[model samples]
Target: MIEQSLQGRRAFILQNTTLEPPPHTPELALHVASEITPIWKMTEEALEEIGLPPPFWAFAWAGGQALARYTLDNPQIVTGHGVVDFASGSGIVAIAAKKAGAARVLAADIDPFCEAATELNAQANGVEVDFTAENLLDAPPPAWASVILAGDICYEKPLAERVMAWLGQARAAGATVLIGDPGRSYFPRQGLTKLAEYQVPTTRELEDMEVKKTAVWKLP
Candidate 1:
């Protein structure tokens, strides 16, 4: 995949977004696009022209917020363990894992912009998180990941099915797999145990309502 340089992407993010604490998790600050309309309203052709995908990294999604909250509250789940945050987006969950005393944290995403965003967000939160633009879904889940966390990943049907199967493999390989979902259309509820529930505040532009009832589920 053709990718922009980290410096260029970082500049673009700083110019477009403001460092603000997400509504649900105020303890951590993220570089979020304050004016959501301009980014969200951009046409597909325009995005292609700009060589960018949907700016999922520009928002603190509800699923991510819920997962971060759950991690911070239940530190034992991550403390001293190597954790991986798949489809890391703004790296909120990864930062939360580090803050909760994780031994190491990796933020994996295919979005080229996510490497820069995750790096900046980790710095903003005073946490160190390694990031990879490599699409982790293309291969087997890392066996070293003692815990795997994913949020807001089940958006499209095909991708949801693929990710679920990959995560299931990770579970069978002895990794603790946790998913944070805000009722996405393709998210599978079966074969998962509810760990926590949260009412997360989000923008109406992203969801049907201003507040989303989100939940954290653990793979059994």
Candidate 2:
């Protein structure tokens, strides 16, 4: 489990020891680094340092842990490939892709703060990744990446449908789309292949229930 020094909370990591939960800075996890596993707490000082504006919710969802764990164990999938983490909650998936030998990695999210968190965590993890705050669906496809990674995006139907549509377009353009979800209801079952399955642990924030197991999946 990783111990989050910022929040003083500990969580189990996929491949190794638990990581200290990241500081509860909006720019760190809620915005920038979507790949780092969440520890479920944060300090107000850390939040202030990141310039988080008032009237913001403190809690967040991080799906990149499961994706990162899978990538770390399946290096062949990302080795020397160009990768992108779409809807990157904390850039966790992109960071994992880089660790797994991707030639280049990009963490993309709609929230500007998420980009900041991605950068912070990338630096903390001793890696480099391209971070973007734009909504990819509104912008043209990034021609640089050949692989797309998504995690926990199926929780919401409208968003999930939009992302899946984009992934289909990306796939049609020759890019591989891989998604890691915990069996959300909106997850599209057809036109995708289950590359792997993992019993990912989850908390109440996103699940809206007690802790439970989540499944990881990949595309054809």
Candidate 3:
């Protein structure tokens, strides 16, 4: 979910991806991989050998597309507010929030390459999104952020547990917390309030089904 890209990674992105709108949220365009790109054929070890991590930034995941749709449709949730987009792969959610009139948006990811990828996507969308390669989970949520958005963060048990605990802290501090998940195993359901759900279109490569039942949830 994070990286600080040297020139090579950014170059790879520029060479490999095209400006295309995600299937579910077609209102915004991003720098994303196409089926024909070399990125798809590269293995994890191959990517690592080139000093790159898995190119999560190259695809728009289901959770992010769901949250982007919800936020755009209901701008009141983020309009005129300072927002933070956590683990912002491809900057899809961040760009959507900005388009929906968020006063300011900060996109944070630990991957160095995500910084470059998000920046490129933001520019392509004609929106301004401040991004940090910093792993925001390493510290407290910023005091000025009134809205916090996390997408697909529950894919891993340890990450889901840590993110939920941290988001809980943010909620306690009065920030509105929202998560987009496709019923990932590590994502708990009992305590959260569901706001919206969608059958998000996804690729077989990225999800179990061609369309996933995903939901947007608010931390109680």
Candidate 4:
């Protein structure tokens, strides 16, 4: 029997989808779905000029194509590592890490909808992940061997600052931190090392970013 989250809630691993609507239960679908196109429409020039999008709505934001590509290519990086998918939207990165053979995986996000989405998605992918709706700045799980953040902390200033601070603490505690982003305004450019780059789909020329430029960075 395939395990699933409790009724009334579950995470979903969106396939061929650049994003997932928030709350995972469809009740909040209006908010989540509404943000998808607008977020995609965000251009590098726009981000550079506007700084960050106002956090007006809640959505289970998967980093989309870039993150998906990274997981597909570097499955080995997560093999045997205890992993945490910070800001896990639709649980894509967590699912990818699980596919990569991470010994354990946890999908953490502040949005309740994201928690449901992560759990459902992980189950759909035949992967088991611990899902939680909690703020990272408050208190992070103690046992995460590695932290994998994809495309979230770079979108807003306060969120980026908080996640970065948490990341620094996690790094100091000897946890490996990896970040995948497609050039958001708040991505820290100072201490991170580039691991790889991929062409992920974007809403630009392709039907759904058949390919867009994205990069992976690691904090040592």
**lDDT tens digits, residues 141-160, model 2?**
68878888887777779988
Top model number, TM-score = 1
> What's the C-alpha lDDT at position 5 in model 4?
43
Write the residue-wise lDDT of candidate 4 on 27-111 in tens digits: 1121233344454434223234454433212233335434545665767777888888777765667777777678888777665
User: Candidate 2 lDDT (Cα, whole model)?
Assistant: 0.62
Tens digit of per-residue lDDT, candidate 3, span 1-220: 1122356667778777888889989988988886523674552333555545457788899899999999999999999999999999889999999999999999999876688888888888899999988888889999999999999999889989999999999999999999999999999888999999999999877777899999999998
Instruction: Report the lDDT tens digits of candidate 1 across residue range 1-220.
Output: 1234788778877877899999989999999986566854442233356545567888999999999999999999999999999999999999999999999999999977788899999999899999888888888999889899999999999999999999999999999999999999999998799999999999887889999999999999
The order by descending lDDT is 1, 3, 2, 4
Supply candidate 4's per-residue lDDT for 186: 82
Clashing pairs counted in every model: 0, 32, 7, 13
Residue 75, model 4: lDDT of 72
Whole-model lDDT, model 3: 0.87
Greater-lDDT candidate between 1 and 2: 1
Question: In terms of TM-score, how similar is model 1 to the real structure?
Answer: 0.94
